[model samples]
Target: MPNNRSAAEISECIRCGTCCKKGGPSLHHEDTVLIEKGLILSKYLFTIREGEMSYDNVTGQLIPASSDIIKIKGRKGSLTCVFFNEPESACTIYDKRPLECRILECWDTREIERVYAKTRLTRKHLVSTIAGLWDLIDDHQARCSYEKINRLLKMLGGDNKDDALKEILEMIQYDTQIREMTVQKGGLDPDIVDFLFGRPIKETIGMYGFKLKKQGDAYRLITIPTGQNL
Candidate 1:
């Protein structure tokens, strides 16, 4: 919060408009339609890929479009969030922006400092939830998608999605197998569901490293693999 009257790291902003220019934000049905008509155009419109949506025949909801979290790019080996606009300077769709951008601000230098301080520990802790994101993060030499940034926001132990889910969503869609893992210490194996998706064997739930056997039981989850995680 050092800048007080200014944006967090605002001095660092070059007003490049990269966030709005190079990528697409998730479009609501109306936003999509407007764009198709060539009316929703902005000086910084992006090339977007839309996702699957369900129909509601009744109207109002129109259509729901999901975007790929945030678009990003590598600048001199540092990855920056694509929507990080520099001039006229703000989120193009601030009122309806997604949770991650919602969490960012033009203040909070302490936050920026904290993230850089324990990055290695945080990366090791969060690697499983994100899996392959490290390659992308490493490509930029910055860790932008870390979900643990919000770990302090956890209020209860059971079902919820705040900081953690926001962190996960920042990089990827929800994995279907989160429910199946048997977490002995509140941690699941590192992003193994894809190479070995579905419920893992019950006995293997808490242990990490190559799953030696195919889980015979349908309902039991198993531990598959894990890395030292940093």
Candidate 2:
């Protein structure tokens, strides 16, 4: 859930460790710096293979970060992750974790995919070129369909688009699983109200959109239901 907390309000959370098992989904390049600075570990005690392109075991489809996502089936003992501290049921490194870790949650009300794309690739390529597919989506919720996100990223710029798509698909699944989605009551974002959704803020109060109004006497924002007339 993109961390609704303001920095001042954000505190280190207690270890719940539900996320330690997968290490994390695809991470940005800057994420490595955080880990290097003692923010988090490699997730794997060590990567058996770094960004090896292959397929998902369950889907039986080749994936780029095959090394991290699934173990080479039958090659080694059932390749469970090294960092999954099952005993503690918590992350070994929480204080210096990355944005991915900060956003991950065990569950959220939103229905999202279970797996997401991953790769040893740095984060730069993911955001600028891959996430740039904002032009293709039909919604203004700042979302890309799981299939669309992969297709667009593959068609756009990337060293390995096929691998990029595979990795990206993993990230998409992972992001949603972690509640890394932007949620709105009725597809409302003031900018998009002006742009995409095209629903007016005040004129059509009952329109198919969210209901919002000024908070206190200040510019703070809050949302209300369409029925409450807030």
Candidate 3:
């Protein structure tokens, strides 16, 4: 027998923990209540901003995100969801999981596919009403948008490469300074910075084959050699 088991025919969850280990689930509109109710915390989340390059597990490619993808943070140094209890092969938040987690079925994936990209929760959705902080986040997005970074990366290979590099360096410096300021001066939780501003440009720039070299208090952006640290 071919063991013709269709996804629809699979009715029970095996509690194998495959999905939780893969990575954290992205927040959806319905999941906002979890955050509002304090079941989930901002410190445990991060954002993939619009136009940022990220791996699409479904498409199996690195693609530019079309909109904000706010997701739970992974365990430090690993992609596994922070709330996953690996020893027990279970999710700590299983009963209060995000919409993506509730809908996900490793064998089928149809339910998750249909709702994954719809009604995603973003920074504005969560913090737009807050005084001062929203202004800072808005300013940060304008000054350090991935859209602008992509354009600058393209310019690096063009006639005005020097000017482009200078601008890129300035953006990187600003991004780093602001993050430090928020933690040191604004009394913000360091863990929540990723959720507020997306990942630091100095680190995320690596996706475009660039890395930073520090010389005293100043920083320089340089291209990585082929087949080297990506």
Poorly placed runs, candidate 3 (over 4 Å): 1-11
Global lDDT of each candidate = 0.31, 0.36, 0.88
Tens digits of per-residue lDDT for model 2 on 146-181?
244434444536666566544444443433332213
lDDT of 1 by residue, 46-126 (tens): 211112121221232423223221112223223333344445556544554433233223234344233321211112222
What local lDDT score does residue 49 receive in model 3, on the 0 to 100 scale? Answer: 89
TM-score of each predicted structure versus truth = 0.19, 0.29, 0.93
Flag regions of model 1 displaced more than 4 Å.
1-78, 105-230
Ranking by lDDT: 3, 2, 1
**TM-score, cand. 2:** 0.29
Best by TM-score: 3
Clashing pairs in 3: none
The list of candidate 2 runs beyond 4 A from truth reads 1-18, 22-24, 38-52, 55-61, 64-81, 109-120, 123-230
